[model samples]
Target chain A: MERILEQIPRFFSGPNMTLLLEAAGLTLAMTLTGCLIGFGLAFVLVYLRQTPGMWALPLRWICITYVEVFRRIPFIVVIYLVLFFIQAVTPDASLFTIAVIAICLYAVAYTADIIRGGIESVPITQVEAAQSMNLSRLQTNIRIILPQAWPVIVPPAIAFAVSFIKDTALVSQVGVFELTFRGKELNNQGYSGLLVFGTIALCYFLLSFPLSMLGQYLEKRLATPRGERRSRKIRHS
Target chain B: MQHLEVSDVRAKYGTLEVLKGISFSIKKGEIASLVGPSGSGKSTVLRALMGLTPITGGTVMIGNERMNYSSAKEVRAARDRMAIVFQQYNLFQNMTVMQNLTLAPLKIKKWGKTDVITEAHRLLGLVGLSDRANAFPDQLSGGQQQRVALARALALKPQILLLDEVTSALDPELVNEVLDAVRKLANEGMTMIIVSHEMAFVREVADKVIFMDEGHIIEVGKPADIFDNSQTNRARDFFSKILRH
Candidate 1:
């Protein structure tokens, strides 16, 4: 136990500390890029899924297939699949780039599913009222539907973002040096596994604690009556 | 010419027919009230007229413009000349009452901000809700919300107004205020079709009262002829059951 306690100080001050810091930066970069690109692609897929008329039928099917395949398969399997394909197509692609691409592809499916739920959560009467006013379909969607769905959409979206940040650990499997990968390396280097892993867990907590707290804060803020009025007042003003 | 006309309008929810061969017409400045028990398709008639429910069969002409229910553009065109106020008031909860009134006019008609606000204030005053203009729907009583909804519908300057039991969802004490607003609108010669359980109000205000049963209009006549001297046994039976309460 004393050796483990002593290792904590060395763990923070040694070469492994530099490796951990670099990996932490990479982890953050992966998470942010993955969430942004993934959400953008997911929004497009959701739009295609809901687009009217026969011309969108094939596109909708493709979107459905994509969401189903990504959401149903394990994330690690998706990481492997993305890694295998990228390596086959371009053997010299950077490992970090491959990891970001893999995380993004995995996140897209869940984001779309959550957004669809948010849209459905809006009441049918809101649409009916918009239509009654002769607001065109597109007008109603943008002005009425989206505004009402936004409060409901945001918290879930932030929740997904926090999870995606944690899910960046999956990238370490493809050998992108991130927090977990660095911790594994340090453990192999003679430090106690408990101290090494405990430090890594602390790093992850440092990153994710704020995000989870943000999600909870937003949930309360958006759910309040005053929040509803304040948001609408801002929009109108 | 009739302000609104429907003939042989057929609508269904899935395989269950809600409106079967329903036909009615309201003159340019008349109030027609549809009254019946629940599930009699009174509300469905209003929904079908506004294109909220798909018209499975038949024709609707709004001010001589034949509506093609299957075409979204044509349906929207017809709706522009008409607006329906729902029983639930269905106010946009995320908007202030003033914004609710102005959103449609500003968005659909491309009206300027100043004109929309002026018109919104006028409508709010008309509904006796000028003080509540800045308030959200959730902040108002049910009656006030329904009145604001009525004013919001009128802000569009529609030639025909459809009211689907607008006062039915309000507290009993609050119903009279909404009815009074409707009565004032009627006095102003707004062409309207109302579906209500306020039988006394219907008898007093409706130029023509149409009694519906199941999926058909059982009787259509002048209020006195229908209420004081209903010809159909079903109509008399309905009146007796309700008037008893």
Candidate 2:
């Protein structure tokens, strides 16, 4: 424990600190942009679920394919693929922007699925009630369906954001100079592994602590009415 | 000839037909009670008229304008002029009573803020729930929630109000309060198509009573006549079963 405490001072006084902050910035930028893109796309995807006939199957397939591809493939492969195919084709683009965009594209797909499931879980009667009031499909989606779904989907969405924040560590592989990259640079420059890596972990905690707390907060908030913790624990086994 | 006429309307869900060739005419300032056993398609007739359910055949004419199944917009216009109080009390649980009442009116009519609040208050008072306007549905009793739903429905000033077993979900003691509210609405000459099983309420407030069975209108007459002298065995059996239960 004393040794761990001693490591904090050595970690903070390390040379590659600015790069740690840079990495944190890149991670947040990527996650937020990706999540926002994912949120809008998810809303559209879920709303499109209500539209009838020939359009229905195709829209569902698009959403499904998005989730399927992103969920099945490793994020690192996606980054490399983007670097190879998309970046190769586009050129003159910064790697930071490309990495952020890639994360956003991938995150958007997963969030869309989470949001879609949340929307679908809402009672059909609620949708029908809104419609019976002469609320157009758009009004129903915006007012009734999405608001109800938001509370249910938020926990997972936050979890994904935190995980994605950590995933940005993976972005260092793409030469983005995120915190992990700086920590690696510092350690390679002869800073002890304990000090450099400890700083990196602390920076990550600084980024992820609030988000983790928020997820915990949400779990508590959602659980108060349900009192399902015991049941959840029982089911896990 | 009428404010609304449902002519031999048949509604189907999948291959199972719910309302088979039910006909009724609702004049302005009329209150008709529709009563039948559970799953007898009493609610389907109302739903079909609202276009919440698609009609397999026949027509619904609202004040000389034909409601077509070809486009949702056409049916939507007809639905806008009618408000339905459902059995489950489909009030927005998250919204306050005032918000629920004001939402459709403000959204559909685009009423001013003062008008929305004033009108919502007036409607809440009409249902005897003026004091509970700020409460959420979760905060209200089953009876109070139904009252709020009634107020919300009436807030739209619909030409015809559809009460699809609105009191069916209430506790026995709570049932009377909602029934009293409906009775007052009936006295005020609101054109109402009430689908219910509470025989006594139907007898007291309904100007005409319709007895449906297996999607067909087995009997249609005054509440007294249908209750006392059901012409068909199906109607008689239904009346007996529900009343006995």
**Predicted model with the maximum lDDT:** 1
Mark the regions of model 2 whose C-alpha exceeds 4 Å error after superposition. A1-14, A190-195, A222-237
* Candidate 2 local lDDT, B200-229, one digit each (tens): 888888888888878888788998888878
Chain A fold similarity by TM-score, each prediction? 0.86, 0.82
Predicted complex 2: CAPRI docking category: acceptable
- In Å, residue A97's CA in model 1 sits off its true spot by 3.5
Candidate 1 chain B least-lDDT 10 residues: B60-69
Candidate 1: where is the Cα deviation over 4 Å? A1-9, A14-18, A52-59, A86-94, A185-192, A226-237
C-alpha RMSD of each candidate structure in angstroms: 2.9, 5.3
lDDT of 1 at B63: 75
Q: How well docked is model 2, in DockQ terms?
A: 0.44
Chain B TM-score in each of the candidates:
0.98, 0.95
